[model samples]
Target: MDPLHAWKDDFRREVEEVLAARARLRTDEKSAPEEGFGGRIADLVIPPAGVYADLREAVAKLKVAQDEAAELRGRFDAKDRALEREREARERLKDSVSRLVLALREERAGRVEAQAEAKKARAEAEAAAAALAEARFDADHAAAKAEDWEREAMARLRGAREAQAQLDRLMLESDAARAEINSLTARLEATACRAAEDGQRAEEAARKRDAAQAAERAASARLAALEDESRAQLARCESLERANQRLAADRAVEAERLVSEALVRAEHEARERAKSAYEDGIEAARQRVEAAERALRESRAAEAEAAQKARQAISALADFRDRTHAAMDRLGERTRAEREQAEADIAAARRGEAQAAARLAAEQARRDAALEEERASLRAQFEDARAQVEEESDAERRVMRERWQEQVQALEALRRGFERGKP
Candidate 1:
């Protein structure tokens, strides 16, 4: 045989053994022989009919229990499927959350880079302004040097003009030379004034350049500081990203663990349900067995009662037969006695016989009536016992159902709690 088939066969054999054990248990529950005055008498006589009826009822109850056990087995299968679905859902949710965390970290990094570039651009603009101011100052300084040379030339031209004027006063000087001197002096003074103004403007431009350079340096220093801050921020962001990744990993692990735990819990719940059903089946079977035993006991008691009644009837019949024989014997012996004695004895014997017959008849009637009463009593007792048993069974079933419902509710609440805790 194939291994699978062998395993199946083994399972079937185990089930069959269980069923056979149950059957044997039921068979052993057959009523203990009724023990009472009536019961003993019943053993010696014909049995009553009520016994069969009780047995039939017990058999019916056993069938009901078998059906209930089958139903519980079906419910176990459904619970197994539900638990598996819950585990799958939890795993999917955990994966989704981890991916979202990674996306968020990437977005934050992009923002930090953009902010750092803006700060660098602001620093460069300040440096360019400083360089332009320095170039303007240099141009002004060159113009000032050119102006000083023109001033010295104008001073020499002025001295030459004064000598010419002195010569004109002592001995008539030339008109052309005087005119040339005047023109040279005027051009020289104009150059010197223009140079002096350029020098002053150059000095002012130099001061402005220096101030601008200082401002540029200060701005650059601030920009460098900002760059350093950005670097630090970037580092912090990297750290935060790492931390976020770690947190995400931790969350994933935690989620997986939670899913695993939920799966375990679901499995545990399924097991608990199976166990509870098994226990319920066992308890129901036990109650059914107990009821069957009680019924059997009642049946045996009734049978014993019927047997006792039959024995009583047989005893009465036997006594009647003996009395009749004794009367006949007396009749035969009467001839040997005196007439008066025989007559009186015969009359007394006849009366005695009649009394015996009447008593026998009455006893027969009483026996029938007692048997009826006993049967009625037995039926009433049986009914009462059956009713009490049913009521007790019902009460027990109700209590068990309530307990089972409470357990189911608690399990459902636990399932809900697991769902709530899930990511």
Candidate 2:
């Protein structure tokens, strides 16, 4: 059998045994008078019928107790089932809490990753803007160098024109006659030719300066375009940086939300756990209270049973005592009557014996008187005879008198002895 069942059976048996013992005590109390009086007289003399009635009552009480115990056991079994269900519920709740915690942790990690990525993107945008600004500075420096070269070339061309004008005046002022003049003219012509070539070179240089200015202007335009592209790129970078900042802010807010949610969930779970524990404690306390109540009921039942048995025993004893007292009263009355009759009979017999003794005494006295008179007459006669014989013999007369005196003394002793024997 299961251990719980075995324990229950053992407890039930113990209760039965206790009840049986109480019953036996009650039976003994009920039957006590039967031992003093023999069976026949006991039936008429003792009260409460027999031990069977008391035993029946005790058996009935035992049955009631057994039924109550069975009911309590059933209630306890139901409580056990409720406790088991609560335990299962607690386990399920704990598992759910564990999963929520794990999910919260994963969300926190994701939020951190998003934040790191946002920082990295902002750093890249700053670096790109710096490179664009350095490129714009290099373009501006190259345009300034081109402007300086154009100014220097124009100054050199102006100086070369002034020298050529002076050489033309000298050639016009020279004489037109002779070898010297011709030689001077040849020199002037050469000078003029050289000055014209210098002028042409200066014009070519001015053309080149114009081309350099155009190139510088083109470079400035390219630089401006580059600056505009850089500005656009910087703007795009700034937009991306703003986006990263916004994303970081959003992720921070999301992380904070997750943390707050996790905290709220944990608080809710804690409250649930505390509530469950409180309920469990209350259930346990209720079971304890129920058990205590059962125990109190059993104790009260036992006390009531004991009191009932005691009352019954006291009643039986009182009845038995009353019967004994009645019997004793009847016996005392009979003894008194018998003693009175015996006293009366003894008084009558004593009167009769007294009367008979008085008559016998009177007869004995008359007989004694007659015997004394006869004895006196015989003596007197013998004395007279003696007187007559005295004339013949004195010795014979003396002997006869002495014999008569002894005969009288013996008769008196016999009479006294007979009076003593009669009573």
Candidate 3:
């Protein structure tokens, strides 16, 4: 193959690469859809709460980041303008600078967005903390109310039990008194019947005594026996009255004791019930407190994680910015060296032509042609390298963005799920 053909082929290949690079640069300049931290933070919070959670750390970070970003952006812009002017002479290099500027702007915008997102996350955390605190306060208040209600109920129950016991004792005593009255009535009826029979016998004995003296003596003996029996019945009635009084006293004492026992039992049962209700209320409140505490802890953890992610993003942005500056510095050095070499070549060519226009003109023309070809080759290489760098940087940025999105979405989802589970 001819060397001219080979050189033409190489030049043609470089032109194709440059065209491809132009297309890629255009694509990279197109902005991707912006997913802000606000949306993610909104997803973290529930609908009922407007805002909660601690935000001091995230807010501080955002403030610092915003200030830093402004500084970096100003520096980047100044540097970019200088580079743009310096690269204006080279068509391929101009495109690279333009692409680098666009990339820098995108990186700054991404960093700003990440910092804003962290601030939003902090707001959500604050909202959650406020919600948890409110829950705890409400729970404590409810528990206190329940305890008060339990105490009041217990007091009422005590009074009711006392009243019920008094009533029970009175009923028992009344029943005992009624029983004693019935026994006394029956005994009186029996005594009256006996007295009637004895009177009838006395009447018969007197009739027989009227017939004879012996009958009269027998009637007297019968009268004496009847009198003795009357006395005995009277003594028995007195003894029965004494016995009834003693039984009444005993029944009263027993009834009082029974009432006391019943009252004690009732009081114990009531106390137990009140205590149980109070305990249940306390337990429920405790569970709510525990749940709220757990949620608060989780929200704190998520916020901290988001802050950490934001910090990492900022750190990565810083690193990228440093690399871009280093690349710009190296590009500046290259441009300077290229300018000096071109000046030297121009000087050497001029010297060659001036020294021998007739004898050295062909050699000088050949040297000029070789220098032009070498410059073309170098330009092609530089364009290719710059394009490759732009493509690699864009790819890395896209991958990092996707990873951050996935992680944020996952964390927000988990936080929502946990909140829903809380009572």
Best by TM-score: 2
TM-score of 3: 0.27
lDDT of 3 by residue, 66-171 (tens): 5654555455455445444443434333334444444444444444444444444344334443443443354345445534544443354344444445544554
Please provide, for model 2 over 73-107, each residue's C-alpha lDDT reduced to its tens digit, 9 standing for 90 to 100.
45545544544464455445444444444444444
Clashing pairs in 1: 41-308, 42-307, 42-308
lDDT per residue as tens, model 1, 1-423: 121233335557978999999889666544343333334555566556777778788677656644543443233233324333433443343334333333333333333332333333233323332332343343234334323433443343344344334433423323343444455445545555676667775565555555555655565565556555544544443454345334434543443354345435544654565566556655765675566557656865775577567656644543342213344345334322444564566577657756765675576567557655655665565456446544643564455346435534543453343324321
Local lDDT at 8 for model 2: 53
Model 1, TM vs. native: 0.28
For each candidate, what TM-score against the reference?
A: 0.28, 0.30, 0.27
Deviation in Å, model 1, residue 46 alpha carbon: 55
Residue 406 C-alpha lDDT in model 1: 55
> What's the TM for model 2?
0.30
